[model samples]
Target: MVVLVPVTSVNWREVTRVRAAEHQRRWVADVTYYLCLSAYDGLWRSCAVQDEDSATVGHVMWAVDPEDDSHWIGGLVIDAAHQGKGFGRATVLALMTLWEHEEPSLSGTPYAQAALSVAPDNRGALGLYRSLGFVETGELSDDEVVLRRGRPAQAPLRGSG
Candidate 1:
């Protein structure tokens, strides 16, 4: 029963409390940084991942690329103590579930796919994303390998003139 609570001025304190394991810190930055991103970018949204008991288990954020009109999920961090409990998978699935229903403002259509990047060496995350259908796109972002899931974006229908 994992749930996502959008990070807000009222809940940022609780969201910031979620942290990754010491070693996993290299893969993700502090939650505060992600929250700051959301504050500065209207297109970016961050959320706190909570378990059935309502305890904060992790944090994740997503954004729609204005250039490509693609949905991108990033800044996923499961608290040090909450790892190996499937919260990571749940959070991602929860995000997909949300997007599956909403129309992107630019496209006026449901999100066709989602993209994310990962450090090539982060085996755990790579495994998680791969298991959930993300495939390598032979692309890189900030030196991280890019992967995407769902159907590729389709060209807009041209009015038959």
Candidate 2:
């Protein structure tokens, strides 16, 4: 069992240390980079993916594209040592489930759509995202493939019924 815990609640030093070596290509450079991004919008919520033991085995974040108003998954990193243990898949599934039903908001307004970018050669990530209903858009970011999933359907407004 994995859970996404608020970043502030975890030992961030350890979370950022969940990194692969310089020779090993990884999605995120370090968690500290993301923590620095906190200088900006509330659109981004940094979270640690904790295992049943409550150990921080991975990291994930959801940020709204301020320009397009679409929500995107960013900085998903599972420690290489913990890779292949299903942490990535499980955490990702939980993340999608969270955003899909939660009616994501940015600056107090509804934020929708789903997007993520994966490097073309990153088969592991492609496979995982594909399994979770993400598809390539043929759009590239610094050579990374952009994928999108529709936001989960929102429940009806209470009084609008």
Best by lDDT: 1
Per-residue lDDT of candidate 1, residues 53-103 (tens digit): 988888999988777767899899999899988999999998887787556
lDDT of 2 by residue, 18-135 (tens): 7753544555567677766653655678778889999889878877777886677888888878887899889877776676556544234364567899988888789889988898
Q: Give the per-residue Cα lDDT of candidate 1 at 26.
A: 87
Off by over 4 Å in 2: 21-23, 39-43, 105-111, 152-161
Q: After superposition, which runs of candidate 1 have C-alpha atoms over 4 Å from their true positions?
A: 105-109, 151-161
Q: Give Cα distance to truth, residue 97, candidate 1, Å.
A: 0.2
Each prediction's Cα lDDT score? 0.87, 0.76
Q: Candidate 2: deviation at residue 63, Å?
A: 0.3
Q: How close is candidate 2 to the true structure, as a TM-score?
A: 0.80
